[model samples]
Target: MRVPVQKQERYIAIRNVTILSVVANSLLTIVKITFGIIGNSHALIADGIHSFSSLAVDAMVLLAAKYSILPPDTRHPYGHGRYETLVTLAAGLLLIVMAIGLFSEAYEQLVGHKSPSEPTSIVLIIAFAAIIIKEAIYHYTVYIANQVNSPMLVANAWHHRSDALSSSIVVISVLGYMAGYLWVDAVATIIIASMIAYVGFEECLPAINKLIDTSINKDKRIKIKEIAESVNGVFFMHKLRTRKMGINILVDMHIVVAPRISISEAYKIAETVRHNLLDEMEEVVDVLVHIKPENTMNSLDLPQRNEITSRLQEQSIEVVEKIEKITLHYVDGKLLLDIDLPLNIIQNNNQARFISQQFADFAVNDPDIYAINTYYHGTVYDSPKVFQIDELHDFIQDKN
Candidate 1:
């Protein structure tokens, strides 16, 4: 299937931002690693490793954006959006692993009582430049992510910001080391690792929630309900359900309408509600509307057609055999039936009147049935005409 133009534009924006991330991180990784070895600063080396990890995250973001935009298929009917979420989870896990490694190395250096070499002024210059460059990349990538509404891209932006933060901590430790505070470098490494671990956990949480089909926020739910109720012909709504699939939302709701309205009108009302929601909420991708009658009990609780037919048979009415269709309407807290019968049942006026009288007498004491209308279809009737029990009641009263 052809992808929509809007989605195509969004994917393009994501691709551009991710490419920018990859280029920036690649340069920073090489610069940090090259200067760290020359200046003998393990902190700079660790920071460079962090930058390299960010490059991996950028690659994941690019791969995810590529597949996540694929149009839905039979094998995956809900589309490939969740692939982005999985990529985000992978990025988070990578950060966590990197953090653990950094912490262990820092702890070993602290325990081994190794004297750290003081970095030259050139390393300080490199660290300052890295902070500036990575911070700029973070801001730019985040702006693009917001424009395209890509969660994975947002996660990657944070990765860039985290690298910038680590570089900032490295600068502080280097300054302290130059001032003869040798323990400062290892402590700073541990601190930066802790921060990275925190951000990783933060990224993992939203992705995990999406994977489990978590609902949107309460405020969004209220707004969606208001929008649905604003549509014309909707008497009320209930059984509303919502869940997140990556950045998109899915909604399922039951819309109540008047029982007497035609099915087509009810369907039109449902369509209107769906359209209004899609217009108002940009993140919503799909809405399922179930039509129901207002002010009625659950249909399952009411008597079934077979049960009603059995009751009529017990009364010797024998109308079930001639029934072409049986429509049960629940209104005003009672059941009203419209039974379509063959025209042969209405042979003459006397037979029609007697049959209507018999059904009326059967309904008079049955509290479940408020009224029953019989419709005849055949050559004689030409058109299906409804004969209500109320008309029979009027005729009997007139005779009395």
Candidate 2:
């Protein structure tokens, strides 16, 4: 099957930007590492390691963007968005490990009192150049990340930012060394490592939260509630749930409607709420709404149509054979029923009212039933439609 236009566009954007980052980081890594060794600048060498880490993260982003756009399948009903999140987490762990290793080496150099060789002007030029290039890549990557709304791309962009920051530290360390300060270079390396570790931890936190299906923030929750309640026929909403899958949000909620509405009406109300939320909230990709009657608690243990019919049969309700429909309504812990029947059983309005009273008297002993409304239906002579006796009575009373 062909890919959707939106996903296709997002993938193309991410792929192009990540490839750009990969190429830029590769060139910077080679230049920084080679020149740092030639000029004997340990801080510049640490900066090169940071660049190499960026290259790894870029590769992961490229892979994630490609696979994350695939449509959902049976094995993965929610699609492959989590693939990007997992890759982001891996990138963070990788950066943290690299930071620890660099920190330990720098600490050893400091403890041993090894005098760092003074860096030539070329090392300074390379450090400055790396800073400029990495900063540029950061801006470009972050821009694409926002346009695509990809969390993985955002993490990768920040990785590029951390590289630029480390290079800045390298520049400072080299300048201080040239000014005759021996300890600043090693201390600067340690500082760069600390920064790398901090950024790594920051990147890991959001990914971990997403992986565990953490709920969205309070403001978003409140907004969602407001939108759901705004829809007509929704009495109220509760049990709202939200979770992040990559950049999209998944929502599940319960809504209350009229107790006596038809199943199709309730379903239509639910679909309306779903469409409203999806239209109003851009990040929400899926919504599951459970519809419940307003009198759910009162109706939970109430007898269904089968049991109610059996109970009415036990009462020997003779008119039951003529009944067309029996609708049960629950309100305030009591059942209200509407029973429809043909007009042939009753000769006049008085008999119609008596039959209604008869049904009520039978249920008067049962505390579960609050009331019974009887509708006598007759076919109009001039029309092919049936009219209820109760409606005709109300119309006559209005004419008087």
Candidate 3:
């Protein structure tokens, strides 16, 4: 949502600057060239070329700004801000070329040693007038660029300034010719050329950085780290990578947290980090948080399991001979119970052998006892087993 708003503002900035630059170029170019040709001033004509250079930059800025604000697509999920950088680099190349052309032409005029004619009153006034108007455009264009956070527009505005500065040089050179000093015009041309080349180099540096996916500066790093640390569960961060596509910045990083934290809590921590980043940094287009957990939670689980087992065992004891050691074991804090009882009542083999010899009635006559099996007192005795029906029958007999 915030993205749409930022993009719209940048679009407006681009449209306004392009219109201003184009209109200014059309007016200034004609005015400078008309005076330049009439006055027989080669330097003034080169200044007219500088005005034309604004048209080139205007095209670059218009394209760069409009494309930079485009929504992310499949190929460029980070949006189109890098297109702005590329166009800016292109603008830089144009500036260097224009400056070289201006210098070469100026050098030829100066060395050829022609006696230059004086400019009419109209040409001098109009050339100087162009300087004033260009300077104003520079200020306004740059002002809007900063307001909307458009780097491409900022670069274009500087292009305007370079033009204005060259025009001032033109004014000085033409005046030098009128004074018949001559060499000052060549010197000023050289300075203006150097100035353009310097600005061109400056524009190229950032474009190259963005083209190569350069890391964001320490300032942005510090901001993201601060945000990650501010969240409660996050203990640290790793794999913090950031890059720019246009105005949009992509953030991919790992966050560390305690292991015992549940899925929902970890999600909340990530959400907080993402929200704070987007809120604080309007340029950020997307955030991907990979959370890691501390390894200590597994150790704590064993002791907790033993404690639960110990508590459940307390509800599981009874007299061995009286009921085969069978007893009820309550689980779920005694809200549920498990019945355990033995199937056999006797274990001695000698008594079973004697009972088989015409003492079957004695065995059957004992109403207090039930099913018995011959085991280790005659065949090794094993632990008594639990019987399912013993609890019901024993309870009824005891009550009766």
Candidate 4:
């Protein structure tokens, strides 16, 4: 499938931001690790490791963007958007795992009898600078994520935010170490790890719900219902269902229209509802509208036209041949049938009444038929004459 221009733009945005993130994280990792070693601050080293996790998230975002931009195909009719969703889930899980590792290492350092000397104003400055840079990256990524409506990018943005938060802890702990509180650095590492884990869980929730095909929020559902029912010909709507595929929403609903309306008109109403939903809701990419008659729930499993015609032939073989049209109405768990016949077939009003009564009797013994109605119409001879080609031409000539 060909990629739309808008979708191509979104892919480009995701790629650019992710590449930027990779560069920033790479530099932060190198700086923090080198300074942590030189300045002897273990907490700053763990913060650098947290920055490393951001690099993994950036890689996933770039990789996921490559496939997620593909158009829908046979194997994946809903498109490759779920690839991004899966990446979001992985990013969240990665944060949790990184947090656990940080926590364990911090715990070990805190309980160990060995103590390291920290003598440096430089470590504090580096950690503080990391906070500013990571926070800047966070805001930039978040802007791109919202612009493209990419959840994977959003998750990646939160990863940057978690890094910034951890860096802030590093700043505080470094300050404490300088003030003769050596345990503050270890304890702060544990706190920073817990914060990362909390953020990881937060990111995981939306992705999990989407994976399980959860419906969108109740407020959106209500708004969708209102939009569908607001259409001119739609009497009401039911069975409205919605689900997310990546950031896009897919909707399916059934709308009721007047039973006697033409199929073309009913179809027009359905099309209107579909268009209204797509236009009103920015996230809704596709909609399916099912048109049904009012009181459809009370409808019955009735015999179709062919079967009913056959049964009618069984009842009155001679009269069945005169039927010009047959209309079947399935309502209230029963079938109401209307049969049209030429007026010439009936000798008089009494005979017409007799035929009506005779056909009406068919419903008495039949389980599916609720009522049968017979309509009589004048023959062509009794109505205005139709013009042939020659007559029409002569008539036009005469008028001229």
Candidate 5:
């Protein structure tokens, strides 16, 4: 199936934002690394490394976005959206590693009592410029991330903001070092590293939660329940489960309907609930609805479809041959059978009445089957139409 328009738009937005991040990180990396080397500022060099790591994350985001948008295939029937979640997890782990490295470097510098080298005016200028540019990129990236509802992009955006915050600290440390507070540079690095680690942990927790198929929040669950109950034929809903797949949500729920309704009507009610969720909620990718009769919710002992079919086959070979479909409705601890059969086999009222009586007799002996109803369809070459229950009743009565 072709992808929906909204999803196509989301993919396009993700691609554009990821490309923007790549361009911004590339420029920032070059500038910071070049100036850090020329001006002899270890802090700026460290910040440059941070920016370079962001470039790696940007690449990951691009790759994830590309693969996650592919249509579902046999191998991965749920689509490839989880690739984005995996990429997000990888990005979080990278952030934590970088944080640990920075913390170690800072600890060594502080404990070794190394005197900090004062950054030149050029280094200060570049650092301040980087702070402004990086923050701007952070806001832009976050905006796009929200627009696309991508956790991967959101993680990348925070990475950009962390760099900006690191640059801010770098400027302060450079000035403090120039003013004779030699420990300030190392202290600043420690603080920046801590922030990076915190952000990394924040990102990792959500990604792990999704990887484990954690349900959506209680409020969202309630909202879904309400939406389901709003459908016309739905008596109620239960067994509603939800989980995240990257940006999209997958929902599975059981909806209870009146036992007397036609199978097609029950199916339509389920479809309505699914469509309402897709229309009313953002990021919902698919809904799997199971229809149940209202009276069956509390019942425990019920025959499986195959067992019921086998019993019907055993009871009457003619039923097995003539019936096109058999639907069992369990209500109030009883089973109601709806059987569809071809009209041509029952030539007149006498045949219809005879088969009806046979089905009723079979049900009378079987404690589980409380009722039986049959529908008739003309032969494909003759009429190619199934008569409604009321119409079939009238035809049988007229023949009588």
Candidate 6:
């Protein structure tokens, strides 16, 4: 869940920046359009149209930033951050389309050598002011962008830049044309159009990069791996993927460790890594760390083996390692023993067999004795009589 914090601060920051951008663009658009009509300069009018693009971009910023912080929903479990990116990309595409249209219009004028007669002084002053003011807006937006790690804000910053560049082109073209050089205006418009293309390219490329899951670079990848592997009992990571979701990053990976470790410990390590990632880089929305165990089944087998090993090790002094099994027989007072004795000592066959039979023989022959049958697993095993015959057997006493 995306718990929305810093909402007021973020809203004020975005709202003020957006208002500033809109005011600047609107002012520039009105001023340029008025001067273009009075001065009879279509290139200046075209520049006004280019500046108009900022209105939509600013609107996008306001709308995008508002929705970006909305809490996660069932439909959007990842929150609405990507909506901001999509809007920014749309704004960039809109700019590119408008620039292309301007290029086509400028191309006709270029071929005709159409001279633009304009009253230069007012337009030049306003254009210069637009440049300074827009650049200021750009810097301010960039500051906010860095502060919040917001891609939408960054896009808005460059939108201000595009406006400044468009205004500069208008100033150059109008000033040069006022000096009676006709060709400079069209050339300037074309140059600004190319810059528009560059801006479009820059904005679109990152969106594509994000969509493609571009590596978060090799240095960071190695660092993340090192962090995960450094935790005690964690072997390594697999499928360590990192990609941007808006300005924030989405990381998913498998964190491998010994299987015997408890879930709480695994969660602790994963939590540590997640916190470190978030602390070190604020632009991470979600990190999914999958806990993987080394060998799952071997963990179950070791306990049973360890339990029997412990029992025998406690019983005898000379024994190094032994395997033993106990079975109660149908016959009354009897226990069967299956034993495998290790070869640390040089003992004769009889001695080895007797050693294997040691527990059953001792237990059975006692007055409380059950009849005992023993199997010598390490040596040859033999079937033995169930119990010894006593003198009473000759009497053939009937028994039910």
Please, what are the lDDT tens digits per residue for candidate 1 over residues 240-264?
Answer: 9998776788899999999988889
- lDDT score at residue 373, model 2, on the 0-100 scale: 81
Model 1 is weakest, by summed lDDT over 10 consecutive residues, at: 391-400
Q: Which has the better lDDT: candidate 1, or candidate 2?
A: 2
TM-scores vs. true structure, each candidate = 0.84, 0.88, 0.70, 0.87, 0.79, 0.69
Give model 2's TM-score versus the native structure.
Answer: 0.88
RMSD of 2: 3.5
For model 6, the stretches where C-alpha displacement exceeds 4 angstroms are 1-8, 118-120, 212-215, 295-400
Candidate 2: Cα lDDT at 292? 84
Lowest-scoring 10 consecutive residues by lDDT in candidate 4?
Answer: 383-392
Candidate 1 error regions (>4 Å): 1-5, 105-114, 301-303, 306-325, 330-334, 340-353, 363-370, 375-400
Provide the lowest-lDDT 10-residue window in model 5: 388-397
lDDT of 5 at 160: 85
C-alpha lDDT values of all predictions: 0.80, 0.81, 0.68, 0.81, 0.83, 0.67
Of 4 and 6, the candidate ahead on lDDT is: 4
Error of 4 at 312 (Å): 0.8
Over 4 Å off in model 5, which ranges?
1-4, 297-329, 336-366, 369-400
Total clashes for model 4: 0
Best by lDDT: 5
Tens-digit lDDT track for model 2 on 1-400?
Answer: 1223488899899999999998898998898899998988876787787788778788888888899888988997877888899988988887688778767767877898877667788887998887788788889888888887877887788788778877777777767777888778678778877988998898899999999999998999999999999999999999999998877789999999999899999999999999888888887888999998997575677778888888787776678878898999887778888898875566566666777778999779877888888876655632234445565555434433
Any residue pairs clashing in model 1, and if so which?
Answer: none
Worst 10 residues of 6 by lDDT: 391-400
- Estimate candidate 4's alpha-carbon lDDT, on a 0 to 1 scale: 0.81
Which parts of model 2 have CA positions greater than 4 angstroms off?
Answer: 1-5, 380-400
**Residue 397 displacement in candidate 5 (angstroms):** 13
Select the stronger candidate by lDDT from 4 and 5: 5
